[model samples]
Every structure is written in structure tokens, then in C-alpha cells.
Target chain A: MKIFQQSSEFDYSWEEVSTSNWRKYGPWNEKTPHVIAVDTISRTIDPHTGILRTERLITCKQSAPKWVLSILGGQDTSLVYETSYVDPAHKKVTMCAMNITWSDVLSVRETCVYQPSSSAPDAKTNFVQRAEITALCGGWQKIKNSIEQFTVERFQQNAAKGKEGFEMVLEMSRKVFAEQREMLRLQQESKILQEARI
Target chain B: MSASLAPECNQVKEQYDNCFLKWYSEKFLRGTATSDECESLFKQYEQCLSKALKARGIDSMLREAREDNRENDAEHMRPKP
Candidate 1:
């Protein structure tokens, strides 16, 4: 079995990083509008065990670059199924597997980890992604190499998207926080004004 | 801000999401962990999501994945002698 792994680190709080990943849809860049939709099949939290489980079905139109499409043949919109287990207390999410049917002959499994980075300052998170591709037929070594190269390039692209997406979410969160704080302050002011009038 | 897998559920999901984000930063991270306000919105969104998943033939896959994940978790938690 050939294993391809990549790791990326980002300057965002573990919560922001983890939450963005759990949300999933934020990571796609504008170029991949081919990502049509995502559907959460189920989400459950074990009251006793505190493990959070979620499953999502992601649909994407296969708009690979010209060379890749030429090599792999034209693929219709595909469903990429993924399930995740999150340990909130430990601040870890194990994307057990993201399975996608590339073709009748190719199956792909991607596993990912999102956690706090020990080497980074307290505000950073480390993302580790691994993909395992299996070709079900014979005499496809050359094709497999092309797929590997393509997958690596996709990983790098995704890493950049992930970082940018995380920052975007972080900025939005901060704005929300400030807005709520302002509302609270205004409410307090109103309460004090009413008391003084009485 | 990610859209829900079911686009129809996006409205409710956003409502719950906003609530959760506020709660997460203003209360949860500050150590309160209270989630009383967003519960109903979350349930509504989940119901919409469940229906959408069933339509997409994804419900069974989720069940299977959850079962596998449970088994894996159990294995991980098992004490190594």
C-alpha cells in the first residue's frame, strides 16, 4: 500500500481551527466551485462518553485541470463521504476516513487529524492529512504515479485554502464577539438609565 | 461560517451556528459551557439534515460509519496489557 501524507500548521486558536474543520465547507477555494454541496447525515454526542460523531456527504463536480481530466477521463459529479469523531475535551478530531469513488477502478481513502500544535505557540493548530489510493486493476503503475502527483498538488492547494479559510472564520468570529459585547454594554446602560429615572 | 450539507437547512443552521459561536466565545471558552438557547434551533436543523441525507442515500452510510467509529474507539480505549 502506498501512503501519502502531508502536514500543515496555521496561526489560529485550536478552537477556531478545529471548529472550521468540523464545519468543512469553509476550506474550498473559489476555483473549486465544483464542490456543489455538503450534507450532514447525522451528528450525535455521547452523553456518557463525551465523544462527538458526525457524518457528511459531500458532492463535487469533477473539474480537474485539463491534463488531469485527460489522464483520468471525464468524471461526473462525485460524492465524497466522510465521518469524523471529535474529542472535545482533548481538542482532537480524527477524520476516520473520507472515501471517494474516483472511478470503477480507483478508490481513495483520506484520513486527517486536527489538533493543537505542540511546537507552535498556544494559538496554533496542526493539521495532518493522509491519503491512500488503491487501484483495483493491473498494469496501472504509470497512472498511479500521475494520480499521486495530482493528489500531492491537490493537498498543497488545500493546505493553502485551509489556512486562508481558518483566518476568515477567525475574523468573523472576532467581529461577532465584538458585536455581542457591544449589545451587552448597551443593555446594561439602558438598565441603569431606567433605574435612575425611577 | 460553513453552510449545512442540506442547503434547505442552511437558514436554521445559520441561526443555530450564530448562537453557538456566540455561546462558544462568550460563555463556553470562558468556562461556562452553557448551551440552553441553541438547543431547539439545532434540533430543527438536524431534522432537516436527516431528511436530506435520507433522500441522498447517505443515511445508511452514516450508520455504518458510526458503527465502525464506535468499534475503533472501543479498541483504542481498551487497556494494553
Candidate 2:
């Protein structure tokens, strides 16, 4: 039996995600069914207010066969069936990502962070950035209207689309994190449990 | 493109995604949610998406698609373009 479960607690770790073979799957065909994303060139600086240059692309595929049925049920009763790649139980994957727009200006950096930085991400940092992106997008809907550019609007939109995209990514990466944490937690729990056992 | 999404569709999409993640994260990751909730989410995703599509007026094209499942379910057949 299959059931849907949404995890409220997210484990933020970087190494587990960077290893995914996102390239082999697909590209940002916003027209297709898969959700895809790429980091954009951004710098964090407190430069005097100006248009912040930042852009990111996130795409996804939603396999709602039941919805497809509602589609047929509400309208045409004469229809039959359809085949698709949608597996309701399977978590979606991100296909491709790239970040080529690195800029020297600080205002543009505000897209990814509030502070400024010079170093590109190492493996460890990459994980941190991904977590930052997830946390940012998770709450993006609230701040979207404050901006003027279609770019920011698009950011809000993609944040909406990719929230699950990235969440799924984090969910997969979290399993390993949870297991490791569990091992450590168990050690700690055991010490406490044994005292209780005594 | 002129055929852009309405704010409603956008909101619905977000709700749908959140529901999706929560739905799966529980079952696959935590082993906490029941099978019934998963089925409920599956149906909810369809309605949410359908409403999103209707808000955009793209539901017709998806409805009329000729496919094997639609051949029997009748409801599975999308309307013509």
C-alpha cells in the first residue's frame, strides 16, 4: 500500500546532494514533466541601492494521474485512458544546474545572500548554499511583491515551482544525514536510556 | 508568453507542492503517515493541478489526448486541443 508523507523536519547537508547525477536526466524544458534548476551568478554586497542582477531557472514535472482523471470525469465521459511517466510514489529529481553569471558588483549578490563573499563554493560550502537556497525559497512567497522586476517575480514563481523540487532533493540527501545523526543520537540516547535502564 | 498563470494558479501550485512534499516525506522518509493520507493527497494533487490548468485554460488540450488508459477510463481522456 502506498501513502503520501510530508517531512516537516529537514536535515540540511551539502555533500549528499552534490553527488546526484542531475546532468544525465534532463534540462529545464519548462514544458516537460521534470523539475530542474541551476544556480545563478550572484554576489552579496551592500552596494548603494540599484537593480540587483540575478536569475535562476527551476522546472518540474507533476504526475497527477488522478487529476488527469478529474480532468476527464468533469468534462468528457467518452474518453478512456493515457500512459505517462508519472509515478505518484516516486520523489522527483532535478535534472541540470549551472551558475555562470558571477559578477563583481555587490548589489547583485543580494539575490543569494545578504552579505558579500569572494570564494566560490567548495564541496562543504556547496551544501550550505543549497540549504540557504531551500530555506530562502521556502519563505519566498511572502517577500515577492516587494520587488519590481519581472526577474524577482520570476524568482518567486520558480521558488514556488522548485520548492518541492529542492525539498525532494533535500529529502533524499536528508536520509543519509538522519542515519548518521541517528547513530550519534543513539549513542547519546543509549547513555540516557541505560541510566534509565539502571 | 501571453498565456501566463493567474495568482490563483500560482497559489494553488504552491499549496499543491507543499502537500506533495509533506505527503511523500512522511511515508517514504519517516514512515509515519498512513496509506489513506497518501491516497487523499494523490486526489488533491489532481484537483489542484486541474484548477491550475483551468485557470490557464490549458485543460482542454490535456483532456483530449488519445491514449490507452483514456480508451477505457473515459475520464482519463483529455479533451481535444
Candidate 3:
């Protein structure tokens, strides 16, 4: 007598995953302020174009990283692979590694996005449910460099040049990130500069 | 896009592009495949999109982006897993 029964392709497809409302993910307190969330409309990543396109929208300032736009690390997910480390010699310096893995997931797209009532209407949210995932298969050093490059290219001033230049800026950033005390000094200097302008 | 900035530009583009690609690659089918299977998946996607574009004609919308993204995308044709 046969014991195992064959399952159809349809059987393996995602049934559903859902969320209630968009608030600073009630959980992750640290990244919450930097976070924005979509209200939500549960839908599958459309395979119509043979590309996965989910229908979820999140409200946020237009200037946000796509990765940061992602849902938090929960709800049956696979990370693009990353790690954080603290250096020894420069005890305060922290290093982050982001590795890549090609095509390694099938996340079921869940909630879309909605803004609270008090917010402006007609503002477009820029998220879609995450119905897929993959790891960028690079080593920690490789991924760290990617983030360093992204920050400098997009946010900081562009003095970085050849390999040495990138390393310099990355090293500077590491020094600064490890010490929040410098932030107060900068803020005070900024206020003084603003006052001087007046 | 900056000529003087090309070195730095190239640096970030490599990883971001690869990371972005990985998000798509691991989405389905962990099983191994022949080169044909890989090419077919990408080509089939283009074909599928080609079929859908008759209505919205995203093909027309795609020209500029394809041209813009062509070199970037083509650079990764080394059969990365």
C-alpha cells in the first residue's frame, strides 16, 4: 500500500500572511523612529510579468533606503545576510558585513500600507508587500564596503576617491558611529552657527 | 553618472546591484539547473513581460531604462549564482 500522497504545485503556494495596521513596528524600538510602515493590502507578488510584484504600500519620507524600507526581520523571512562586529585596536569601531546569496526565497506578500488619519491625504506610500527574498553572496568585508559606499555616495560629501579614499571615509565613519558623544558637539556647533547667522 | 566620480560610483554599484539581484535570485527553486534553465528563466521573464506589454506597452516604457540599465545588468553575465 502506498503511504505518501502526491501534492500539486498549487498546494505549495502561499496561503496568506497579514498585519493589522502600520505603526512603528510595535516591537523593534531602536529602528522604529527611522521606520515607516505601509497600511496594507494582502496580495501575492504578481507573477504575471514573471516578476514578483506585491501590492502593499508603506508611507515614508521619499528619502529612505530600500533595504530599510523592508519589513522587520520576522514573519518567515531570509536576510540578505549580514553581521556586525566591534574592532579590537580601535575598540569603539564597529564593522558591518553584508553578504549576497543569489535567488534564495519566496516570501508571501502580506499587508500593504496605510497612513494614520491625521496625516496628509493623497500622499503616496512607496512600499509593496515583500513576497520574495535573496542573499547577496558576498563576504562581510564586501558587504561592509557596499554600505560604506552607499552612505558616502548618497549622504556625505564626496572627497572619497581611489581605494584609499574609500577606506579613509569608512574609517572616519566607523569612529563617529561608535561614539554618540560627538553628536552633541555637532548639534551644539550647528546651533551656534545658526545663531551666528542671525 | 559623474565622470570624475566613476571610481567611487563603480564601487557602490557593484554590491548594491548584486544585493538587489540576490533578492530576486533566491525567491524560488533552490534546486540546481543547467545553464539553459537559468537563461530560460530570465528570457522567459522578458517574454512574459513582452506578452503583457501589449496593453500598457511597458516595452516602450522600458526602452530608456533598458538602455540605461543595459551596461549595468550586462556586466553581471558571468553566471553568478
True contacts kept of each: 0.22, 0.00, 0.00
* DockQ for all models: 0.31, 0.02, 0.03
Give the Å error, residue A186, model 1.
Answer: 4.6
Query: What lDDT would each prediction earn against the true structure?
Result: 0.64, 0.30, 0.26
Against the true structure, whose TM-score is highest?
A: 1
> Which candidate wins on lDDT?
1
lDDT of 3 by residue, B1-81 (tens): 111012323333233333423332333222121222233333433343344444534335334333433342233221222
lDDT of 3 at A116: 19
Per-residue accuracy of model 3 over A68-101 as CA lDDT, tens digit each? 2242222222112111111111111111111111
- Highest DockQ against the true fold, candidate: 1
Which candidate, 2 or 3, has the higher lDDT? Answer: 2
Off by over 4 Å in 2: A1-198, B1-7, B10-12, B15-19, B22-34, B38-48, B66-81
The Cα RMSD in angstroms, rounded to one decimal, for candidate 2 relative to the true structure is 20.7
TM-score of chain B of each: 0.78, 0.40, 0.34
Lowest lDDT sum, 10 consecutive residues, model 1 chain B, at: B72-81
